[model samples]
Target: MDASIFSAPKIDCHCHIFDPESFPYAPGVFYAPSGGEIATADYFMQVMSAYGVSHALLVGPNSGYGTDNRCMLDAIRRGGHRFKGIAVVENDASASQLQDLQAQGVVGIAFNMALLGLAHYANADALWERIAALDMCVQVQVQDDQMAELAPRLLGCGAQIVVDHHGRPDISRGLASPGFDALLRMADSGRCAVKLSGYDKFSREALPFADAQPFTDVLLSAFGPANCLWGSDWPNIRATRRLDYGTLLGVFERSVPSEADRRTILVDTPMRLFGFGTGGN
Candidate 1:
């Protein structure tokens, strides 16, 4: 692929940083990388530079670090303009702690329903107010089957909703799938936005992930360009097979196909949702 194709400034709205030695992983964490190929802030920066990604939203990786966001916080502070963060906090997190996180460039909180259940967000009302006061969004990771029950609750929380992993749809059922349909309905409500990410998680196919394009098309149509964001899901830790950063970028280009739409998904939408810049791409 031509490097020029990625010339427009891009923001990776979802990625992670893990430094277990400094910020040790929680005991009995659900998942942890077996090999030593951990992703760090400096490594992520190198990847971003190679891909023309000017900014990134470093989400707290639930699998490795659990709710300890110290590693992510340090990265955001060190990265300056190059990185922002989405932290994971306990339900009883105090106001001052949230303020401190906001001052450090954390624009949202992450709720990984796959690991933590709905009970984890039992204090949604309070969390909503705290995050809303900071003008932050909420990042949600839920399986396709959980959408119907979870979407309504998240929408009612009164904070901007960012659904992760193309809403983690069931590709076998396509658009007719109940969870995917609920995702579309949530997007239609105008309060929710979906991240065009984690193709490796949702697609049953191999590289190029052509099978996932229809889901992307429907999400773009339902949410429109402004409410949609694109992410590399870098390092692609969950991938069953080897994947390349450049190849994934090409997949996005081929899937979206229009320069205008590409600009929107790759640049404009994330900038607007994550508060990256003053103007559109």
Candidate 2:
């Protein structure tokens, strides 16, 4: 039996990179970019090669770069076939600008509503329409407090929605919590997908990542294998050193504990979500 044939095709659905030494941070933003001087796309490729990840989604980081996607675009271009990107756009970006981004292999747009607040994009309907016509997805990072207030409107905007950071659910509130339940409802409608990343963000513990499993269980059950995707959340920000991409991957192995489940989470699903396949390439 060939090991390559049996080996899982990993697709990382979330990650961020920036060259702090070259790119100046956008001023006046509360959310700072992840530390590490210039962790380039080449670095990520080496890590992926070590882990058997063949493809990845390069999520543009919110390091106060504003709408200047130059660094991210360069990273994706250099990453070649191994990477795709999701970008940040001004609420009023013109259709031509969006079309240009799509041409550059950007498949989605991410909004950090938790930190930026919903009111900023009050006039984003036109941009949303353009995205819908282009068939792009929208990645939203909203914690539980804002999920009730913002998720429905975001979902109603007529584009595929990717919920970030384990749907930003409150673990202490349990599985049936409104935020997690809302995510389930979105998955039920078949228009939403969730990233099984960022265990350190929600859990209070130092290790094992057991505290984050309930949220993962709900996502797995609600979205089934197809609508779920996994991310390394490399160089984890808030909890920083407690977990690296490798540590997260290990926790996933222990928690999921099934090759079939892992395959869907790691491979099949992300390809489908990111439009990487149609008749096996």
Candidate 3:
């Protein structure tokens, strides 16, 4: 009998929680997620329970909340070991604030270069160094060839890096794309991990995102099982179409057919990267 994908302990390495009702959106943000884009912590926990997902690493989104991490902080506080977080902060945010976040269960800082632009974080090297000093990771989300420019510093920053969305590679440019190549090269440093998710962000085509598969294949090969992880990208914002959680899992299941690989991506890697354990709720 085939092993069930639902039977194993799984962790979602990237996802977001939007609770504007309790934590209002930051004023004058460029994009505010509403309607289908909202997922309260309670709702997400139920969804996780339904899918047999044991824990999720909730991201502090740039869209609505910007540098305000109260929403995600509250969720982590209430989640009872079921949630960990990556927070968003100003490039010049102080060490005290970051230490406070870390004390509250945030494991990393988010660099949403895709939304905030590269220029915004050009002076972030010191911030990265500080994050590394605290033993936390930097969660990066870059689009097109942006990572090519940032990879050099990020690799040298001494922080554990978790890259978003298979590097959000420009599939039209193929594996030879400079940005994608740079992202792949970061694997050699052993401090980088990539998520197999957010297909809608880079894929020119629909559903299984066939155009993006070559990039994903290269990522899986280059990053290897230990550095590769799975994420639902829950509460997907600005999506071209509706993306169901189960459907997303199915796409990942099809992409990686081997049960051993699946377990590594779904359970083991996230455990190592996000600090989830079997003892947790």
Candidate 4:
């Protein structure tokens, strides 16, 4: 294996920490992360260290802890500034509650429509307003053509939209698909960003998804290098294929071949987007 990827400082824009032992799974949860899916904050830091990842944006998982951000809050507290977060909140979350999470290092809110359908957030206009008012972003994970419906409302509210998983495009439909096209149009908004991640989420093929390169190309062109972020959806929960931290770094390397572009995606962009200091945890 090549050891060069570890030589640079990198921030994982998206990852998770599930500690069912320290914090038991909440009741009425969608799914519990037993066995291989379980990953404590301590374990994730160790993994980051091993793979040359300096910091991470810890996204609060919807499963096993819906609207209860305590587990994620705990991880940010213990992470010692090495982690920032995107929290999941109830539709009617108050400003004070958002301030509480922001004070603790949460920079955004996660609206994972890919897991919870679009209709679940139909009445979220107020939520968007709150997130924008607090200077936080809406980190959205929508599949296929969903972006078309969500983009106008998101931009209309003046909330920064941080899209997840390369817009989770329908690969068979090609790049001009409604959702991805709408995503590209967002480039002009100066308020949208897409993660150069989650190849396994949409790709019909395997890891190191060559099938997704064309889409990646247009996204970079649309959003530009600065607006694009990279994330490792670590622990591979609810994922069909195996995912490794190191392997993902390599995939990123291949995806953006330019050294300057890679530097921006791996370090500069995230450091600017989230508030991560240099050096590993």
Cα-based TM-score, every candidate: 0.92, 0.90, 0.97, 0.96
Off by over 4 Å in 4: 1-3, 279-281
Model 3's lDDT to the true fold? 0.89
| 1-281 per-residue lDDT for model 2 (tens digits) | 21331245678888877665566667775555555535667787888888777878888777647677877788877876677889998888877898899899899988887667778767776777688788998888877766666667767788888888887777788877776777778886687888888776677676676788877887888888788888877645555445666667777777776778888878788888787652323
Per-residue lDDT of model 4, residues 23-108, tens digit only = 88889998988888999999998998888788899999987787778888898998888889999998899999999999998999
Q: By TM-score, is 1 or 4 better? A: 4
* lDDT for each candidate structure: 0.81, 0.76, 0.89, 0.88
The prediction achieving the highest lDDT against the true structure is 3
Q: Write the per-residue lDDT of candidate 1 for residues 1-281, one digit (tens) a residue.
A: 33355676678888888777677788888888546448888888888888778888899887788778889989987885777889988877777898888888888998887557777676676887677767788888877677877777777777888899898888887797777888899876776888888888879988788899899899888998888888888767766877777887778788777778778877788777777873221
Ordering by TM-score: 3, 4, 1, 2
How much is 247 displaced in model 2, in angstroms? 1.3
Off by over 4 Å in 1: 1-4, 34-36, 122-125, 278-281
RMSD of 3: 1.1
Indicate the residue-level lDDT of 15 in model 1. 87
Candidate 2 lDDT for residue 108: 91
